[model samples]
Target: MTRISHITATAYSCPFDKQHQLAFGLGSNVKRDVVLVRVTSEEGLVGYGESHHGQHPTAMAEIIERGLAPLLIDCDPLDNEGIWERINRQQLVTHGLGAASMMALSGIDMALWDLKGKLLDQPIYRLLGGTRKKTRAYAGGLALGFLPPDTLQAEVADLLQQGYTAIKMRVGDTPARDAMRVGHIRQTFGDDLDIAVDAATRYSLGDIPEVIRYCEDNRVYWLEEPFTPDNLEAYAELRKRTAIPIAAGENHYGRYAFRSLFEARAISICQADLSKSGGFTELKKIADMASAFHIAMAPHTSHSVLSAAGNAHLLAAIPHGILFEADVAKVNPFRTELAQPPFGVVDGHIEPPHGPGLGIQIDETMLERYPAIAGPCYLPIERSAGPTG
Candidate 1:
């Protein structure tokens, strides 16, 4: 019958070469913790999945091992929908649907899909109705911040040389500095390259007009996350005021949150992360909804190889798929440690990965080498309360 026998999860923390600087967040030496879920069947075949553990590896692992594993064990792994439904019906856990619970579910759901693909002898994209087209990629996190203007120019040159037709730069250092950098990149790269800017939600509603105008004048393709996800009204205002499309939804999780964004007309480009948005189960729904609105999905990719692989397959499946975020950060685990570093960008396009399921193989040795180090890599400044009352 190929019943699900057991599910096991482990966490790993990998260090980055340097601090990853963003507008609202600062990550010192990319402390990436990945949760690897192993789903074993009665027939003895095993399928693997990875969840980007981010700041909560132990919590995520505990959820999978203690909370989810008990319910998942002895169930049929082939009945993905049934299993997913059972998990979703857990009132206690499903209420928030974020943080450790969702992360654990993401891992389990991926492993379930992986097992299904292995059982059916097909790749995940094929199972999702085959490829629509080659997944296109854009150079992401191209080292705009913490570098001199000349060094930034050199980095852009390297990205262009690496066959990237499009690239996104981190902004929000200072509006004037950002404008100068954008102008420099535009002038240097010319109008041939598609340049996008991400403020990482550091800007307020007042900052949007200037940023949008600057981006539009400089011929920037898109401006991402100008305001926080909670500021939908600001996003709506920004959308109304700007010619430059606003890209968001990476911070927003699930279809419910995205539907609100769509209803509000707050976002033009949807950048859902498979790892963060409840895995493929929910992300596919989100993609379909975005497609109905004629919105393009340029999925936000960072962290694990599973995310990259899963996103690549999803991109191949969705007709409205646009650009994939290729992390250009040197210390990114996606490039260094993750199982299948995505197909190298060739002429601005990424070829879909070919293998059963997500096509990612975990390096257990490497996984063990990087254990969880102390410190919250993404603690917000507002939450920096001390031990004293």
Candidate 2:
């Protein structure tokens, strides 16, 4: 049996020149530091994972190196589920279930899966019962912030021209502003294109009526995160009042959290993040539950290549998988210099990469060039001072 010999973590910062914005937050031009994990077995097999250190790279790294690594040094590398359970059960040092812990576990779990795929000479999706279809994608977080009307129109046109059938725009800038943008996009795209809005937890119950009206009037596909994560009553209320389906779950942590959402009938679409929602293990359970409820899944992705690939595989396995989020922000390594030239985007829809594990071949040398930098590269506008204003 191959026992784990060492677990190593390093951090890298990749700059994004464009300032991306949501209703509640903003990201300035900077190279976000991403924490990478490498697990080496006594038999010399190596598996890699990524922790998307958006605003907490240092903290995530500290937890992985100082806290989680100690637990895995002499353990069996193949016992992924057992190891995850043990870490979850840790009374004092077992904080790897949520936030930094879940982030760290995501990397570790990915590495384990990678190792398993390599050992068996099969792709992770194949090991997970093969794919149902070539994964389809949608434009995600691409058209956000308050841009000039003409500029926003051009962006939507470009995405449509690129062959995207569906696109999500950031809402909650203000109901009036959001209405104007949504109306403009709907008018331009007509009823054929699928358009969705992300309120990003910026709305109150007071804002829901107008927002729901805007979505229905414009034939919007779904409305996401209209209320904060804890406000399930608000979600249920909003769902009852609106014909447009309510979508959420990106901010939610694990299956337990999702069970609450399902029980309340708070969501029609679930946007689970593979990296944050306890990796493949927890996400699989969440997807299964959504299937039972007949809820559609469109996973949230804006982290690293590993997350994108992992989501693609996971989405492939699910019956109700609809669209994958494609970060259309230019100048980010995700769109530019990361991995190989074609990061699997084809005619606006991304096809899953056909290789082992996550099927993402990261450029290690590029990672070395961009050592981990401190602070969040993308700070919310309020945190970014007056420039965003």
Candidate 3:
């Protein structure tokens, strides 16, 4: 019996320079942040998982070390559902920690699954009864933001050359400018290229009609998070106005919120982040639920290769899974240097890791180099544009 012996959530940050910084609907990204969750069992076997920093690495780390670790110590690492329920009942429900609790738990839960896989000497996908297979991927991450049309087109062309047939660009500038960016890509690349746009939960309901007009005219693939996660009505309303698929769920917390998305018939595509949406335990249920409603599954990739590998496994295991968001940010050490064989696109698709657990090896020494930087990863919306004067 492998019992959990110890758990730690260490925060890490990698700052971007002026050359690599990309500004989108949310703000300009200055740094990438992630909480690396490590779980060890009594026998000395170790497993790793990642939690999104939630723009506050220390805060998320504190939640894991101080808030969650006590509850999980001595629990069976193999019993993922049982352990998940224990935390769900104790912290998430009773204390009302909401998304913060869920996000922290996401990492812990992911590590436990990794532990379970290592215990049995199997990959996470095999543990979930999934076969090893490739899933379609798109060029995403912090690149392709609100750049000038020519600059954005050049970025798209580069991703195409890398073998990605599909790409997601950032939007949520003024409606006219946003349309110009979308239209430019479609006109430049023609219809063979698939273009999806993410507004980063930055748009209001009033901003939709015009955006929809351009997306429709340009044959855009989908319009993601045009409004915040809580705005179910806005999503449902937008669906009525446009044929372009509405994709969301990255910021949403658990299956319950996703269940609401189904009941409302709000989105045609679901993009849950495994690191933020309660990890594999909850996300598997969410994926099953999505299958019933006929919604496509495209889990959002986070700051590191851990989530990238885990999401690819989940997508491969599930029947309705459609696309994977490959983080093609120009500079992200967390995705490249921190892990080996860095996650990549092969002919526009990615496959689950074949090694035991989440599979890739990590260099703990890398953590020292990227000690957590204080403050948010994104600059404020106004400051992001810089020098409008």
Candidate 4:
């Protein structure tokens, strides 16, 4: 038995340069933080996974090291479900730290899956019974954000040249400003390109109609997370009024919340994050549930190549997996230097890395080089907006 001999969650941070900084509805992304989970087996096999910082890298790392690791130290690494349930029952459902607990476990669970793949001598997609078919990739992450219309258009042009058929832009600056950006991109690119806008949970229920009008007019692929995940009523209400697909779920945790999203029929697209939504074990269940509801999934990858690679494998494996949110951030070391088999695009589609597990090799040197920076990655900034829900 390859018992979990050791587990550690180490947080790393890489600050953004002035050029690469992305100011969006979520505030400026001055730096990227990730909690890397490394799980060691008795037989010397080590697997790595990433937990989203959730704007608090140090706290997230503490959750893994001080909260979840003790409970999972001796558990079987291959029994992903059993491990998940054990944590859920023992801590998560009890007096555990809610989303933070899930965020911590997410990285650990992903490491377990990585270990499973290595143990079985198979890549994650193959283990999940998914073919290595190429999935469509969208240029996303902390780029294509709030900028002048011409500048945003130029950025979109660069992405198009890079062979991206689709791109997601940040909105919620204001109705007129957002519309101008979207309209400019639409006009410049014509109808062939797929444009998705992420509001980053910044909009109110009152802000829906204007967003929908431009989305419909420009034939936007989807309007994502105009409101926070807990605002189910707002999502449901917007869905009723718009032909544009309402997409969300990156901030949502677990299958239960997703089940509620499904039951409410709040969204036509699911954007679950493997790193935050309970890793591969829970996300697989969420993907299956989404398929039953006839909703297509586009896995969200906001951090390092671990989540990007994990999402690619899971998306390739799932029946209803639709698109891949390729991190197109200009200066993300976590994506560029921290890992390998870079999630590249070919003719605007990305196939899973062919190596065993996540097909990644982390550079430990990068960890030492990019030590975690203290304080919040995104500082709160008040924005002028209409009535909020």
lDDT for each candidate structure: 0.74, 0.75, 0.88, 0.88
TM-score of each: 0.90, 0.91, 0.97, 0.97
lDDT of 1 by residue, 322-361 (tens): 8888777656554566574434456778766677776656
lDDT of 4: 0.88
Alpha carbon RMSD to native, model 4: 2.5
Off by over 4 Å in 4: 382-389
lDDT of 2 by residue, 12-106 (tens): 77655445433332433455566777888887878777665647677777777887888888887767788877766772244434566767776
lDDT of 1: 0.74
List runs of model 1 lying over 4 Å from the truth: 17-30, 91-97, 340-343, 379-389
Error of 4 at 185 (Å): 0.8
RMSD of each: 4.6, 3.1, 1.8, 2.5
Candidate 4 lDDT over residue span 7-67, tens digit each: 8888889887778778899888788898899999998899999898878998889889888
Of candidate 3, the 10-residue stretch with the lowest lDDT total is 380-389
Q: Which lDDT value does model 2 have at 212?
A: 78
Q: How close is candidate 2 to the true structure, as a TM-score?
A: 0.91
Q: Which stretch of 10 consecutive residues in model 2 shows the poorest summed lDDT?
A: 380-389
